[model samples]
Target chain A: MTLYSFIFYILAAVILLSTGWAITRRNLVHAVIYLVISFFGSAMLFYLMGAPLLAALEVIIYAGAIMILFLFIIMMLRVEGIEERLFPLKQWLPAMGLGFISFQVCIFLLISAGSEEPLKAAMAEPAIFGHFLFRQHWLSIEIVSMLLLIALIGVLHLGMEKKRKESGE
Target chain B: MIVPYSHVIFLAGILFLMGMFCTVTRRNLMMMVLGLEIMLNAAAIAFIGAALRHGHMDGHAMVIFIIAVAAAEVSIGLALIVCIYRKTGTIDAGCIEGDVCEL
Candidate 1:
């Protein structure tokens, strides 16, 4: 196999296995860690796709920011480190079976469809990406900013009032 | 091309289904959120693969938007999870009782 195909296969395997492991873990923190690995793998795969800007954003935003958010929430909830929660065979087995079966089905479907050959890869440089993002997608950017602001306000509204009462007692 | 476009799509499908399995089987609220994040990652992979396949900047643009949406989602979701823990004293979705959390 070509080096490119080899790298692609390895990254894809890394993502799949890490996510599977993450889901199977009983400890929430452990799961989050695995999720981070999976996200990092996904970011690398994004790099392989030639969208370097998107890949960097995936690493920064998803692997870095999002995971830190998860860890903070877990810490605040005081469920850090190991957990005593059990994943019984009843639940774990069924989920594993479902995941495996779906994986098989997807492979089968992909092979059956007989894919067209992929085109020559193009590098999507950040300079061009930035211009297109701001120029053609300005409206989406504005809307997303508005969404983030509303979410921030909602979170503050949800959190501050409750804390005030709890501390007052 | 390094790998066939269809193979990338297949990989995305596996990740999405694995996420689905996690969401369906897990009783913990945080696990469900993690599952959702995995599902979003799968979507991003597919988008990036499509961009590579077509040599179009539009797919890259879409992936960027997806990242923005995912960030917003995770922020709001984690906030909600923290709120739930504050009010209910637990994050177990299955154990929620008496209007504390609805399934």
Candidate 2:
């Protein structure tokens, strides 16, 4: 295998393993930390896949901002030590069985389906990507920004509501 | 040829399955949200792979919008989770579902 493909396999392993760990952790903080590692692995994979801009954005937006937000909220709520009954037999059995079946079916189809051709590595430069994004999806960008603004306002209102209730009580 | 396009799709499929498993089995609301993030990230990975395979920027652009939506969804979802925790004094999905949450 070429260096690029080797790196891709290694990164994929890191992502899958870390994510598995994250989901199984009982402590929320530990789970988020593991997930950050998983995100980092994916970011590297993004770079290897020739989307350097997305790789950087994955690091900044996902591993940095979003995970830190999760960590912040986890700490703020003080639920780190809360004990939870994870993986009840009823839930675990069905999910595991279904997931396993579906995963195998996907693999089978992938192997049997068309196009065994390899992907050609092509990098998307940030400048061209930005221009294309604006030119083609400017309206969508505006809508996303509006959605973010609404989310911010909703969060602020929720926090304020909780505070007001505390005062009123 | 670096690697077959199928390898990338396979990777994404595995990640998506993991996320789905997490979402289905996790009892905590926070973990559920985390699962959703994983699934979204998996989709982003698939999109990037498609972009690379097709040699186009559309998938890259879509990933950006995905990130934006994830940020928005997480913020709102977490806020709602916090609100539920405050009102119910518990973050367990079972408790919430039973409507037996006691503050």
Candidate 3:
């Protein structure tokens, strides 16, 4: 056991625990808070991976920007304080069973993959990552941007339709 | 007692499983979305763990892309939830089921 492993375990524990809390909590706001904790843990994990840039971006983009938006919508829509019904066991039981089985399968596959030679060796220069992203995956970058654009348009359409209905149009 | 990269992967797997559990079990729409975010973040952690294990930057790059997608997903999802709230007046999963806005 090394110091790095110790730190990794602690962070991983925080992430997993927060994820469980985020899922099980009945209160929507509490779930969101747990999600923020989970995000923080992931960010720390990213930092441990030797990608400080990715770690910062994870915190800033996911935890800071995206989650704030989610919270804002929850607040503006007044959904946070509302009481929700208890979980419906009939529907969830089957889903839970299936999810567990699939998850186990995935874990098995990942473990098998890990036993193979690891991917590329650790590079001394991180900037090579940036170069590869730009040179090889530029199309993926563009596609993601396009997807965001479409999502934005979808949101606007939904908003407009809601307003139209409200105005009795 | 330090753990190793493999332990990190195991921990991330547990977290991912927990997040999936929330996604499956939660009835509140907002909570479901929160669960989805957690699940996605768990995947991100796994990516980072692999990157550290291999000492490569590709995994980090992948994490960046995943974060970008998560942001886009949340923004769009929140917007839809807002619309769902306006029409149904509730964020419960059952309420939105038969409502005109099927999200």
Candidate 4:
């Protein structure tokens, strides 16, 4: 009814439609591009929700970095121009079933979680967000750092093994 | 109230379901990974929405960690996909289960 509500609905429609199209698209590259647009929609939704810091992060990390990584991998695999590989109705059965069930569950959760009233949007600015991360959630930060380190090492090992196998052959 | 908090949850849920649909139906391994990234973003949206509703900074912090973890995951998963392509010569996930092609 209000402007905020109108904008929220528009963004949600953008996200759902783009992502639905992305999933159904047969071209991997095209799908990734569509997904990036959906990510942008979600990022704006984050901004509207008063988490500008999170919104920026969503754009930077999700739409920017992660999408580029997908593109790079798609190129590496050379699965280009494989146009319109539609999943048969049989193949779509499971995704549809699961998606429907999960959506119902989520609605139920929202209803049970109370607060049918709309939220008074509150912004968690970057300064306070950073303070909370360092002061209140310092342990999580350290663990995440360690996890990133491990992932880096694991990826390098995998790449190196591929070279070793090629040379041995 | 401009928009109901529940509206945000519903939106996120829809996005998450879309991601799941992509993951289950995609034949390409890379596409599946992209689906996973979408699902993670949906979670991030929900987290931020909850933070807004609660007047806390925890949601932003959670999103930061989610972003970091998603980056790490995508990097490692893509590297594995490269190895898969090198060994198998195809990115089609069902190529292995076809039983005609020797692993």
Candidate 5:
């Protein structure tokens, strides 16, 4: 009813619509573009959640860097013209059933959780959250950075092997 | 007054459902990857919502870590897709199964 809720509903709608488009679209590039829209929508949701830092990081990292990498890989692979049949509907029936049931459960849980008073009580000092992250969880932070380093090394190794194979042929 | 946190969870659920639809119906490898990204984003939104509801920033920090993981996943997955394409000349999930063909 308020401005924040209105914005939240609008962004949610966009995210849902774009996600549907991303899956159903036949063109690979179009799907990726839809994914970008979905990413931006999620980032906006993050901002609404009182996390401006995460919102920016979502846009910059996921929407910008990661998607660019995906786009580049798609272009390099050049699989646009390949013909493929749609997956059979029977194959997805079980998954669809499970997804529907889980979705309902999730909605129920969220609505019930929202109605409780703990959330209001939980809204104390936000600064304490930062203190916990930078002080108590510093080790996890370093581990994350190390993981990124390993990923980078793996990517470089893959790229070099690819180049070597190409040159050999 | 305003329940912005509730809206966050609602949106996240919708997004998660959409991602599930994508993952279930799509046969294209790239589309599947896109769906996976959507699902990840949905989870991130949920984390952010919980963080806001709790008046904590730790959720945001965890979201940063999630983004890094997603980036690394995209890099490695796309690289593998390229390799597969070079060998098979196609990115359809159907064809790549059963036999390992030469590039």
Candidate 6:
């Protein structure tokens, strides 16, 4: 394997390992920290895959913004002392069985398709990517912006403290 | 050429399965949302890999949108989770009536 593939394998291993740790941690803060590492690994993978713009955005939005949001909520809730059944046999066994069966099916289909071609490395420069995105998907961008606005409004409404006095008035 | 496209697909599938497992087995509402984020990240990786394989920008575009949607989803989902915690005094999915939350 060449240097790029070697780096890819290492990064993939890091991501999988960190994500596995993330899910198993009982402390939500610990899970979020592990997930941040996983996201960093994924951002590097995006860079290796020649999506530099996505790499940066992944770091900025996912590892930085989203994770911080999760951290804030976890801190605000202070539910760390709430003991969780990490792996109740009833739920764990069924989930594992279903996951294993689905994964087997996925592998079977993948092998049946039998495409062994290697991926050719190509880069999408930020400039060209932006131009193409705006040119073809400006409407999509607009729709997403609207979606964000709606989400913002919904969050504000949900987080608003109800006026108990108003009910009596 | 770096690696076979199948390797990327395999990686994504494994990540997706792990995310599914997390979502299914974890009783915490936050963990479920975290699992969803993991699944979305796996899908983003797959899309980037496909973009590289097919020599197109479409997959990258999709990932951009995926990230945006994830941001929106997380904000709203967490807000709802906070509201639930406020009403029920616990974030545990199993403790619906607040009896189990002794603290």
How close is every model to the real structure, measured as TM-score? 0.88, 0.93, 0.82, 0.89, 0.85, 0.92
| A1-169 per-residue lDDT for model 4 (tens digits) | 7788888889989998999888888877888899889999988988888888778878888899889988877776788543335567776777677767887898897778666777776677688778777999899999999999999999999999978877899
- Kindly report the fnat of each predicted structure, to 2 decimals: 0.67, 0.75, 0.56, 0.80, 0.57, 0.76
**Candidate with better TM-score, 3 vs 5:** 5
TM-score of predicted structure 6: 0.92
What is candidate 1's DockQ?
Answer: 0.58
DockQ for model 6 equals: 0.72
Judged by DockQ cut-offs, the docking class of candidate 6 is: medium
Q: How high is the lDDT of residue B71 in model 5?
A: 83
Angstrom error at residue A113, model 3:
10
lDDT of each: 0.83, 0.88, 0.71, 0.82, 0.74, 0.91
**Candidate 2: stretches off by over 4 Å:** A86-96, A113-115, B97-103
Ranking by TM-score: 2, 6, 4, 1, 5, 3
Model 1 scores what on Cα lDDT? 0.83
Reference-based TM-score, model 5 = 0.85
Query: Which candidate leads the pack in lDDT?
Result: 6
CAPRI-style docking class of model 3 based on DockQ: acceptable
Comparing 3 and 4 on lDDT, the stronger one: 4
lDDT of 5 by residue, B14-65 (tens): 7777776676566677877887888888888888778767666677778777
Supply candidate 4's per-residue lDDT for B89.
74
**Model 5 CA deviation exceeding 4 Å by range:** A110-132, A165-169, B4-7, B98-103
The alpha-carbon interface RMSD of model 5 comes to 3.3
Screening candidate 6 with a backbone cut-off below 3 angstroms (N, C-alpha, C), the clashing residue pairs are: none
Tens digit per residue, CA lDDT, model 2, B10-84: 889889988987897778889999999999999999999999888888999999999999999999989999998
Off-target runs (Cα >4 Å) in candidate 6 are A86-94, A109-115, A161-169, B97-103
The share of true interface contacts that also appear in candidate 4 amounts to: 0.80
Off by over 4 Å in 1: A80-105, A164-169, B99-103
